[model samples]
Target chain A: MAVNKRETIAKNIARYFHDGDFVNLGVGIPTLSANYIPEGTEIILHAESGFAGQDGAITPPWDVNDREACDRELNNPKWADKENGWKIGHKDICDASGNLAILSKGASCFDSVVSFMMARGGHLDATVLGGLQVDEEGNLANWMVPGKNIPGMGGAMDLVSGAKKVIVAMEHNAKDGAPKVLKKCVFPLTAINCVSVLVTDICIIEFIDGKMTVVAMAPGMTKEELQKRTEATIHFADKIDVMDIVEE
Target chain B: MNKVVDIRTAIDKIKSGDKVAVGGFGNVGGPMNLLYELEKHPEINHLTTISEDFQMSETPYNQGFTGLLLNGQIDEIVVSFFGHKKAQAKVDAGEVKLTLIPQGTLAERLRAAGAGLGGFYTPTGVGTVVEEGKETKVINGKKYLLELPLKANVALVKAYKADRMGNAVFAYTAQNFNTAMATAADIVILECEKLVENGEIVPDQVQLPGVFVDYVVHCEEVHY
Candidate 1:
């Protein structure tokens, strides 16, 4: 059976994380890895937007009453509720600015700190981020597309370079059937020589000894087909196995 | 001096062709009330905005600078992440210019300006496009790029609470770029959800001192 590319990539990437790992999941496919974390392993997930230590997924039962109460306080200065009433057992739900508001429905509670300190201090054990293209030398070019009006390079550069290990989770090929795993990245690079592993829809490629080597492939996807899709030279591992992706 | 003012008066501090630094990561902690007020003043054009993230999340919370960008108020943006499709369309259409900086470097630059430093050296973007025209120095067998401090004519910040004296406290992740932007601008405007009397907040609770604040406005709702 053919496996979903995003699920396969996310599942394979989750295997690299261990217990007590300070993992940063970038937006997109990497964020999906949270759903595939093994049952017993404890991973402290950090979001650069300012929350850390949340469980895999941000489930809901969010404190709606607390949000309304905070909203009331905002308009009425005479409302003397100094303390934010939105408390889910020591967890405070505030508006995005941290004001006492209804807890955001899909978010989990986390410790707050200066996000830059976490990024620059190199506190992350691993970062799973998406990539537009990853070169043979492990350089990442996920921020910009050449000649295209690219939005600003968000936290990808910091996360890619600051994390102890960088795992790129992306589709094996672009929508037009071009290889994203390339010999040389044609797009503007986010960071140089930073990517450690590549988890794509079709195969798991690792940059080892300065070469792009295929360590595993998706079920029924042959090495020959992966080679045809790739633009760079490829090598295969001796004990390649079908990727195991847990279904939700 | 007490710096608290209404949003209309706060918008008056911004002029045409001004460089403004805003605090927030996406919609979180953004000075939405101030930006909305500024948006109404169409004469305030050619604004060069400095921020961490430029794109809105396509949610209702997407109200701040994205609104300004959509209205064609922003001329250029110096940001770390520019992923909003709506804003990207503007850039693609040549309505806006973009300069991308590494996220860590952008934060440190703002911090350096607030701290009164000339410039600092960082290892980020040493050999990439970020290093193209910047000065580079090798110290201790390591390459570092000399990044200048980024200051602004006006800064709009979002805080959870503020005392009448303008001292502010930030909530959770909403404090992203606010504390740094607060001190790096000539005129600092704070949008707070709650206002307290002077001396009500403990010194330790103050994330930004009143000395850096020039204006404070009570903002009941800021989209995040």
Candidate 2:
């Protein structure tokens, strides 16, 4: 069995979604969970940019055939010249990353104030986010990388504080081969003891009573292999199940 | 009252060291025409901007705050998302001072200023670096950080349409920070894509009331 890390992680994460769940997917790998949502489940995706019921992201540089009209009217070379540049998808329909997104039929829009009100009011059920570092204490550190230019924490803190279940959907290791599932987070914390579950490339871990327990692992992967990639001492569930990766 | 004015006339209200709140997330809902006009004036320096995002670099047209940042027009930024690598370089080089606030906290702070509230306690940054140096109180056994209101000297807002009476209507999700920032500032200058007569926009359709608006400028929407 071929182990496609991101697809397997996304597929496994999708199993947690219940019907009629209002979920917020953060930028990066968490956004991929939208595509792998379990069949027959109705999940309303929330965009912090004042949109709820987001369907999916529009492919970049939305195809425009009228080059001359685009040039004369929009004056955006990206819109005019299709091959070289990117088109601004829609004026108002965008995800948190400023990429254009399509909305569901019953989607609603509001101002920034009302949007965060929903987030901070505990109206959301589940929030899946990308993480830089996650500790055994269920603390997540994802917003800022130390010594780099600080990109301000957008909405992670508020979501973590408000959401009933916070899921960290990311790769198990960083680009430098360091374990992101760490003994303790060296980076600044986005929130303390806020993460409920973690779906990584190699395993699905859940925080049960403040303990890191591996509930599932990727196909052909052993506990020793998973532990070798993880920095924290992990406990295993009684009957560990293989991650469900629906192949195309 | 006839609040409609030219773009330059509206842009002239911003002075040096003014606390300016701008609307927009990235390229959407930004007061581009007004900012474009402000970018021409090099004298409007040492300004503090309160916004949701940096209005990162867009292609074709150099719209949003990048022009102002490049010209050293902005000194301090109280924002939620300091976006773009180039904008971050400016911050790392000590060109602008950044006060990063969580997105919801930033929104609520502006709402507090607009609603005449003193401050709010939020559980967002309770155990994080964001709560450091701030007062913390335990309510119902939950720790919450005390975040204060943030008011601006001038607010530059964008609307899809506006009437002569200054009633503004926003389109779709374009009303991001524009609606909130409009209420939190002393002077609110609104730029609209279409300017109409007094009775053009219906009473119920108006997103921003005329009472809070000071000036209205008719400017075409710049396609990002």
Candidate 3:
């Protein structure tokens, strides 16, 4: 069975995430991956706003009645959520005598000190980032598009430098059809040899010894077919096989 | 007695019937040492505690509100997000009385109370049902206000560093409502991790001056 490029990319990512992993989903494509995350495994998502141990939908239907569903349970917990979530809301009300205490579940949030400490201290198991250019040496060029506009580096530097596993999700081609996976990135680099795996629409690219290695390709896409689309040098694994996307 | 005293003697100052305001937002700027000390002494009881989140590890609301509940110390708790299933379950079951406030309003109210203004107007809980029976007035005939005062009996603050004279500098979230709250309280207690020499803080960096301070509980380490 032949699978398309995007579908194959999603499966490869899902394969890496196991149950109970504390995954920080960055804003764009990384954030959408949560929908595809396998349930019952509890990949707790952390948002910057200040919710802790939260996994339910962001805001329930706006009706006053539906407001009660604000803190519904989702599976698993992030590293920070496990310790101080109770501190995120009213503790006394939670222990009130007659009323049932509803624990406010915020699957997304960050403690100012602890949140940054964890990111800086290598507590996050994995962080998925987007990239403007990913060079052969696994150098990540993200924060800016080289002199477009600098809107302060928002946690990208910390996530890039600190996360144990840095997974990147991006388009295989630029707007001009130029390949984003490059031999040498022209933009300012965020971190060197940081990206662990590249999940693109076309194939799975891994940074091996300062070069691009294609571990897996789309089902219908052949070796020659994959290289043609990419403008840069792409290393093809000798025993490369089609990804098991459809089966999953 | 309207006075600010040293925290080493804060236990003596904090009575059973005091409503204390703690500083911190989502556990960022809390005075954990003072609270921890208050817990350990077990000298005082029946406290009406106020603040954003009571983040004790054991029970979601364990160390806190329970002290208020079992002893009947807390008559009422004003907070937001207390309705998060676990805490709301307790509220609905009749164990405690929870007066829910919107998040931003809670902080501003604390600030207002600290600043000594009787009440400030806010458009937060207006019109859509949050404004239930509270006196809603029109300002400049524009239909723009609800006035709620900031009130607290005692304030507990945590800081990164403090001078022997009592100036404090906060870490990330600033959670300085506990600081503003200090102005409103008869008693102000500080649990500091680092106590520097007097005149250590430059005028620019000093957040809360010694004039508002009464007691200092010198300590090392935070409750992480």
Candidate 4:
């Protein structure tokens, strides 16, 4: 059976989180990293939308579509009949992507001003975000495409600039098969020299001593295969290891 | 003094081309009733709208900036995130001038305006388009971009509860930009789900003081 690439990458990224780390997970593949956090290793999740310590997300059909189907599966009929749909949590409690969130035990919420203060004030231990392009200089371009797709930057700029460690979790290449780890980013940059680590489906690269260093590769993947998929110039560490893909 | 007023009276204070700062992370603390009232007054056109994000929904009941955008009222918008597909189309078509800022900078700009600061320096947008045409300074050997303060003519904020005196208590994450926006605007109008007597709310628990709030209006509870 083929490896679940997304889960594999997420699991590898989760290994970076230490116990009691205050972490922010960007939308898309980065959000999946939360589910792969090793057991007994707790981390506080921060959402720039104004909250921290989110434990998990509610299962979708965020809105109740088929009443009969909802009634058959859900243990609580009341949750299935709510106006916002069969949500395990409150409608107002959501991540930046508007997915209903199930907060952790000690979850606390605040306004955006203070929420961003925690981000810009250098309180976050780490933040994992998606990337459109990452350059050899550790520059990341994930916010906008200019004249094409301009979904605003949100808290990405602040997160990358302020977090103690910045991790980029993304696929190795663009959907069109172009290498995303580029020699230079053509798109608008989110931040400069901010990415500390990059985790892709096939490899894990970290910026160390001002160089893009490949420290790990997916099992059965050769350096040449990864080099072909990456556009940025990278150096392999003397002892490269297979990335741990097991969930536990 | 009592600050409670009817919704119409509160919204009527807005001018034709005033800059309006709305408080919300999407619609969490959005002043939907106030924005809906503003939308009904098509006379108030060519306004500059500011918010964290403009969330678009097909649901008619959702009183987000989508109505103002569709009504062709907003001439410009400054936001951190805008996922409204139709609004983006309008932006690409050269209808609305969109200025995107980093989220932390957006919040700090509003705070700086409220705090009466000239501007602040930060490293958020050093090598991006945000640094273009902006002052750059090297502090302690690291480059920082100078960001100016952002103030507005009026601010519309929402709260879970408020006293007639305008002291407010926000519920959950609904306090997103409301607190900062209240202090940054010339006129601050707040809509509340519940209204209480001046002495009912404990002073220590007040998230926003009455001094920053100009008017208070009771609105139907915002569902989600």
- Local accuracy by lDDT, each model: 0.75, 0.84, 0.58, 0.85
Taking the tens digit of each residue's C-alpha lDDT, what string does model 2 give over A1-248? 55677777777888889999998988867877777877788889888998887765422334333334434533455333455323333556667777655556577889999999888788999999988899999999999898876788998899899988999988899889989999999999999999999998888999987899999987788999999999999999999989876554
Model 2 interface root-mean-square deviation: 1.4
lDDT of 1 by residue, A157-227 (tens): 66775678889988888899988888999888888888888998788888888788788887778877989
Q: Each prediction's TM-score against the native?
A: 0.83, 0.92, 0.47, 0.93
- Higher-scoring candidate on TM-score, 1 or 2: 2
Ordered from best to worst TM-score, the candidate numbers read 4, 2, 1, 3
Error of 4 at A96 (Å): 1.4
Task: Give candidate 4 misplaced runs (Cα > 4 Å).
Answer: A58-88, A246-248
How much of the true A–B contact set does each candidate keep?
Answer: 0.42, 0.83, 0.00, 0.76
Error of 2 at B190 (Å): 0.5
Instruction: Enumerate residue pairs that collide in model 4.
Output: A64-A85
Q: Pairing residues by index, what is the TM-score of model 4?
A: 0.93
TM-score of model 4 (first chain only): 0.86
Please give fnat for model 2: 0.83
How well is each residue in A1-248 modelled by candidate 3, as lDDT tens digits?
A: 44454445555666568787776666556655655777676665543323334332222222212223323321123312656453232221111111112233433332333444455457677878777888777777776565443332344555565667888887788878887887778776666668888888768887677567888876677879778777668887777756655432
Report the CAPRI category for model 1: acceptable
